[model samples]
Target: MANDDGMTYADAPLRLGRSLDIATNRYQVSGAIRSVGANASLPTDTTDVLLETGLPAVDADEVTVGDQLRIGGQTVATVETINAHATRDPNQHRVLVGLTLATISDGDTTRFGVTPVRRGNTLSLATDEYELDGRIQRVGTLEPPGTPTIRTVTLEISEVREDFAETFHAGMTERADDETIARVTNVDVEPSTLITTGDDGSVNVVDHPINRDVTLTTDLQVREATTGTTFKGRSLQQGSTVVLDLGTTTIEATVVNADA
Candidate 1:
């Protein structure tokens, strides 16, 4: 009988029987048939794709390894690894998600929420528990982290206390949790200039200096990761601010220069 495709199936069983006979004869000539084990397993199909989201770090932190991903109530993949990086916005983070493939239908697109899982596709990531809506900034294998190295960074603390500025010196260490992460190699202090604006919005610098500003040259050990070179979860780059904890006090300083 022919179906809608106009293909006859009346002799399909006979054809299958003949094909099985041919295979049996070949196997017999070669050797005894190997018994198939019930517990035999096939190789798993997995793809490492980058998933980006604008979710806050707190929410992004929820997507850990070994998490299951599903769409339309069907399991599609498993989370293998995750890395979170802060964006320009202090409140938002972009996350990388590595996924292990599962049951995905042909031509059926997988989506993180309503966003399709396509390269450069911007969408939010959603699971049964958390709905993290954002964009997929990248798609490919995750790059390995680079080796850690000691990098020189220049930081400036404006309008610092006179006593602290006078006592600040090289060999001072920046500590976090009682561990030193950076050491000051050089310290430069200059009189902080006082500026005033005129009625016409013109700026004027006063000759008299009131406060002191200290520029600190420090060496910080850092590693180049997918996000960037980070120390204590903060990116160490020009224009970024890092808080240094001295034994006596803590000071927030803006990075003016950073070594590549």
Candidate 2:
């Protein structure tokens, strides 16, 4: 390996300003330069960026905190912490994390980058700006016996997508199982006024004076909008009001009469 600025690695690990060459990506040490985190929305410094791409299993050392970082050829930020796992799977061995990027790290730099490779991965962290620029160190590989690793294991928050369907489904095939389905029969959905009965057995207020009877619809669907699956409601309604019992939160819904 060749040095970036007239220097070479002899024996004892390495010091600041050394570069780590994993596959084709070069991690240059810039400790002499100040890093400014370019992240926001968060109120603290807690972001973890993992570089799980193009890294060799046997030749990639784990990352540490306070290391100025770069990934995917972009200056992401500084690493707040390094999660090391002594496992056979090189990918799971390390998880480069960037918990938060809101608070400044008592310096002046901005951004870190993460580049993923096939047989291995690179985990890097970044501050709100970039506080790990010149503070990056070359993460070396593990000692003998471990195969040079390669693969990509990166997880990022894509974005807040909208106007999508929400669904949750799990497929299961089983035998010798008793299946049961329950339904409510006495409940009727009719139009009625809502009244909260007072402790004295009297309603606190009759909000729906025109509603004589009520029907209730209390069904909840727990799922991600991006997915495709929903939970239908099973309610008991009398007129336009329905009685719902959802754990701790309870709400009363009135039926809207269509053109009768």
Candidate 3:
């Protein structure tokens, strides 16, 4: 049932972002977002963006508070809180999500872009503009009025460092490899093992020389030599071109190996 405005809670027309949680099955859904206010101390420093998406009665039951939402593969927020409001019709309800921005850490910087906000996820809240570039902070669900099923999602979002001009272009590329040994280092290898031969008059013993030429190829995850973050591994793929930025000159190389 729709309100006097003829807009039901299920009538979210805009599509929000995608799920940040890669483990969950990916899904696409339409929803609405609004900006309430920000921290008074630094209002512009951090902003709050709210999202409301509806689910079918059956599907609403499966929606959890911790669920993730994303747009364009960039995680917007986690389900902070959920609310289901019953309409005049008994069979339908609305799911309102109070989503906070995802905290844009250094690790998130690479995958999300120089700046977290994307044009696709922007929303017109009152007179100001807001974007989805936050993570879910807290969430919970509430019982719907009457018999309608309901869910509630909440979020606490932080602001992204402004860099609208940094949006991706057709030829824009991110340089991953850094030649600074100070930050990154060559893979450490184990010392060679050796076996000694038995002396002529001494007890007889077998001696074997370990293979030294064998290159160490590991299937383990590659982390930053400095921060131990998964930023590089997450962004770069095998065959991807990598440019190591050193203060003096840039070193270009190909990604020989990579994995999730």
Q: What is each predicted model's overall lDDT from 0 to 1? A: 0.62, 0.29, 0.33
Q: Kindly provide the TM-score of model 1 when superposed on the true structure, using C-alpha atoms.
A: 0.47
Give candidate 3 misplaced runs (Cα > 4 Å).
1-46, 71-73, 102-260
Question: TM-scores, in order shown?
Answer: 0.47, 0.18, 0.23
Residue-pair clashes, model 3: 31
- The 10-residue segment with the lowest total lDDT in model 1: 13-22
The alpha-carbon deviation from the true structure for residue 255 of candidate 1, after best TM-score superposition, in angstroms, is 3.8
Q: Which stretches of candidate 1 lie over 4 Å from their true place?
A: 1-45, 85-94, 100-119, 144-150, 157-191, 195-254
**What's the true lDDT of residue 37 in model 3?**
24
Best by lDDT: 1
Ranking by lDDT: 1, 3, 2
Ranked by lDDT, the better of candidates 1 and 2 is 1
Off by over 4 Å in 2: 1-62, 70-75, 89-92, 99-260
Model 1, 1-260: lDDT tens digits are: 55454333334422212322224432432222222233533333344565545567577767777888676576666777665544445455556566654522223555433244577765444586676454444444533245567888999988866776898899988543234678999999988888899999999987335578899999986677777887544577889987665656566789999863
Higher-ranked by lDDT: 2 or 3: 3
Candidate 2 per-residue C-alpha lDDT over 1-260 given as tens digits, one digit per residue, 9 for 90 to 100: 24454323343234443444434244444232222133322223433333322223232243445655444564435545443222234332222233223232333322322232111333333433432221221222212112222111111111112111011011211111122111112223233335598888976755443333423212222122233221111121223332222212222334332111
Ten residues in sequence with the least summed lDDT for candidate 3: 149-158
Q: What's the C-alpha lDDT at position 232 in model 2?
A: 16
Tell me which of candidates 1 and 3 scores higher on lDDT: 1
